[model samples]
Target: MRLDASAGGPSGAGLPARLVWLCVALAAGVAAIALGTATWALAQSPGPAPTTVGLALVCAAVASIAITAGAAACVHRLARAHVRTKASASAGQPVAGQQVEVYVGLARRLQGLVHREIQLLDVLEAQVEDPDLLKGLFQVDHLATRIRRYAENLAVVGGAVPRRQWSRPLPLVEVLRSAIAEVEQYARVRVVPPVEGTVRGHAGADVVHLLAELVENATAFAPPHTEVTVRARRVALGVAVEVDDRGLGMPHPEQDRVNALLADPGRVDVGDLLRDGRIGAWVVSALARRHGITVKLQSNVYGGLQAVVILPTPLLGDRPPARPPATEPGRMPSRGEPTGTATASSSMAGASPSPVGARHHPPAPPALTRAASPATAPAFRDAVASGQAPRDAGAAGPLLPRRTRQAHLAAPLTRGGPGPVNQPAGDHDPTLMADFLRGASSGSGEPPAVRAVPRH
Candidate 1:
């Protein structure tokens, strides 16, 4: 439920008026007490009968009560007037002929705000490279992006804009992969793969915005270094995308807050969590409602928040479209190889294939290293050979040149072993390696795929 300035509540802008009323009540009580004491003193001093003093005290008490009541009523009325004025001002603003216009304006403003906020964050990031600082910056950036996306989604819906038919079947895998890449820049986490193949649906920009908000919110509230898993699957009726995070689970208070916000979009205090100064959730909800998409928010099995967006099959129609055949040709039926030959082939595949003589010579270590061989060289080479590692994996060695490596090695290993490996190494389990490679290579490899339609 939204609670804005116009909302009739003690905690709103009328708080000041409430305080005034409270003060007035206190003063009246004090005055009544003083008057009673004076009346009692006068009667006891032989100036007036004790009964007169009592009567005077009663009158003073009645007067004080009446004054307090009047003051409260006056304060209430004043608060009501203040609220009405604010509401009138908002309503008096010219209403756009189309919701789309309003939405587009909101989106543009949000975009500017986000761009400015991100620029500010970049400066902050350069000033302090601490992990905590970086994490916070990422959180803020993610929030800003979410707000911008929500605004954009609203704009799309307000305009009754229909996305162009995808030129070809969408590479759902590629879309999700790109999203994961974008998310990784700020999230101190990894995204898990979906259980099924690419989800087919209406390819549009709204999909990206929906996924971004869900993933971002999950990351922001999740525990540090936890993984956020995204899964997409085709249900009998439509497509479902699930984003799961293993962070601080949603508590009743937060749930209540979100529910209240959804109920009353106007009451949202967007400034609290987002740097972009826009109400992200309200925009998201509005967009979702406009599109007839169903969004379910729930607690994840891993004790974190899970957001599921189910886009009805055909997304815009009733029947699922036929999927194209796979790109790769089917494998030929293989005759059983002799045991010895099979063993040799397996050995060859498992062994490092780089020519021995062609191996790159290890560069000399710096002053700090003294005698130690740069341990990371082998690992770095192995990572690169794996073929699907993130770009950083290939640049890891040179980025740390020999000198920097020595410095890193010399620094007291605060935690045993090297800093947590950001990406899996070549030696990681084959299944995991395959998944990572798939995600790295294609933008649509996971849930929350990229927009399949080309933007005009």
Candidate 2:
């Protein structure tokens, strides 16, 4: 089989520029040499000989420089190709971008999975009272949160959005603490000065995420024993959050490059972070540029890096009150907990009576183990009082086997023939009538009592 290949990129464009430079250099050197040789041959005395020799030497130097440059470029290209081959061999694939896509796709899905697990774990955590169980749940929840952050890192590198946002403005202090809580080295982070401001709801989530990235970077590069600290203070224009660590600081040139990227991330797509391996700086820069936030890095007094994020006036708001709306009644809102508003099935849920259509439909006749006759109305009172499933004669428990009595068809009525089977003609007690009426009025799924025909 034969393969077709089309040259592009440097092969089609950049290769010509290098060749043109080489040709120009060679032409200059050759012209100089030719001119020098002619000058020397035509020289009538030693006075011009010296000038001719100098010109020839200059030509030789030019040729040497051009040749060396071309040779260096060839060696560099070979070295780069060798490195790529080695990498391809080690990784067992030529398509690294495909691997990145797969990894990021899985990471995003894993993020959702971890979030759901954390939510379930949160619900379970609230229900369990044992200290040990609560501790275990907290640990699991923490791990899930870490996994969520890792996934966010992958998402940011993949040029995707982060997965957190506050529906309302959060206090600056709270945002800082929340960001700190997300880092793996949370224990080492200490917040100071108790800032007073609110991160605008629109920017709260991204700000928190940005801060978390900076904080994580700080802690990761720091020694285990050293502490990373965060400080936030209200400023005239907005909020300034500083994250500092005691780790070895970044070099000045690197710091300047990072700052430049943060200041002007115009065309710098964060997706390049996959190849760049600078996830933290790229994430910080991308978020900062997007949110109108500014990030500046400086060497700390303790020989560490300090990242300062400036939240502009628009992204700042008045601090939220200590008691949020949900907590005004003395409790935090449960996640997605239903509000106090009335619902279609509210009657079933509370003291109010359910309308006929809104009530739970009564069990079908065949499913009924009991008579399901008018007498069934009274059983609801017992069911309600005892909080147990109502029972009647021949009524079996939900799981038990019971014979389904086939309903008999009533014969046509006639004076000589037996009349249709009649229900027992017991005297209607007013109290039973009242109880039955009460149960039915209460929408207790009570069937109405059958009426009897008076004897003529």
Candidate 3:
């Protein structure tokens, strides 16, 4: 990549200039040798030859000194260029016609470090509340170790340090929770699965980089009192981690911009957002890609933004085969069904009503076509009148059994063939209605004693 001269400056040009100077020195040395040899030849036939030879030697020394001085000047220039480059790269850019800014870059780097440190401390605090502080301490130590490792990696990239490997399994969830908790102190944020659990695979520094950026962005954009939730779920292909915030939702245009930035993983420039003093969303995108994960931003359920990172699953060598999906007590319903309902029709058939008011709508009748027996009619009528359907029915299927009972109840109220009576409207006691529907017959089998229906 050709770094812009104005951006990184002439730091890279130093080596070439030094090589040119070396060539000059070599040429000077050769010329001095030739001149000295000629002078020695001339002095051999004359008086005071040794003195002439000394003069030639002095000339050679002078040439050598001149070459050394030239080389020294080149070296000085190279050092200055190196310094300029370092200063330029670190200082970044200033607004048009303004003096180059140094504090901004330094402040950003410092802020990043401080934020990471605070996150580590929060994780440690979370661990302390546990009865087994040793485990907590281990987690804290692991996270701290990973952060240090990442810092070392950054230093190596900056040419200021060496590379190292993390031999022990790093506690990623601990570190991630810490990062989230640290941000939550000043920002409204919630970390899902706040407790410790192991995720498969070794993620290295990339996980930390992506999560930190995500949490930081969530904290920045979310409004006060708005919660930012970070959750991770293990999937068939991999683990999917989501950071959701309830704030001003990202507009479609901005979402598109974010997508474009993620498409090209190489670009680290946060662009205008950073330039305008806001942390660029691109930072999260770049880090996610580095870890072999795909990042996507979308509207969250609460009408805010969500940052999702899908990481590839790791293979466990020599491990036992994965177990089949076990049937849990509450099997979640299929996509089209209401949330949290069981999917199996048999389970729904025996399912009892929740405590009175707590009950959800009862399941619909089963698809059987048999006529309702006399014994079941009254029971069915009461269930329907109370807005409860039979359990044998499909939860979402037609209420055939209930409808049949309603027909029976309407028969008593209706004289002609079978239909609802056109009775006048009046405030009737609900209990009376229930009692009447419950088949409590007046001594005579006629309709129970009741007030005359009011005329419309």
What is the C-alpha lDDT profile of model 1 across 1-456, one tens digit per residue?
111111122323345544544554454444345344533455356432344434444444454434333332332333234234445657896433432243345334434443454454454445444464355445444443433343344345344343323422244444454455434234443445433333333444555655665666676667667778777765433457787888767676766666554445457553341223223354455546655567766777787777777765333221112211112113110111111123333233222211111012122232122112232333334434543234323222233323322223322331233332311122112133333434444443244222222133
Per-residue alpha-carbon lDDT of model 2 for 1-456, expressed as tens digits? Answer: 000001111212235534633453453345335334534433544332344434543453454334323322322222223234446766896734443454345446645655555555555454555565455445545545654555554555444666666443456777888788777678899998656556666666677778987888888888989988898764434568898889889889777767776787544433332234454565566567777888998998999999888887556542222212211233221111111222322222222111111112222232242232222233333333433233121122232333322223231221122321221111111133333353343233233232122123
Q: What TM-score, over all chains together, does every model reach?
A: 0.38, 0.45, 0.37
lDDT (Cα, tens digit) per residue for candidate 3, span 260-351: 66666334344343333322243344344545567777888888788887754331111111211112224211111111222242133212
- The root-mean-square deviation over C-alpha atoms between each candidate and the true structure, in angstroms, is 23.4, 30.8, 29.5
TM-score of candidate 2 to 2 decimals:
0.45
Report how far residue 214 has shifted in candidate 3, in Å.
Answer: 0.9
Q: Candidate 2's C-alpha lDDT? A: 0.49
Top-lDDT structure, candidate number: 2
CA deviation > 4 Å runs, candidate 3 = 1-165, 170-172, 181-187, 194-202, 266-273, 278-280, 315-325, 328-456
- For model 3, state the Cα shift of residue 126 in Å: 14
Worst lDDT 10-window in candidate 2: 1-10
Residue pairs whose backbone atoms clash in candidate 2: none
Worst 10 residues of 3 by lDDT: 1-10
Rank list by TM-score: 2, 1, 3
Error of 2 at 388 (Å): 52
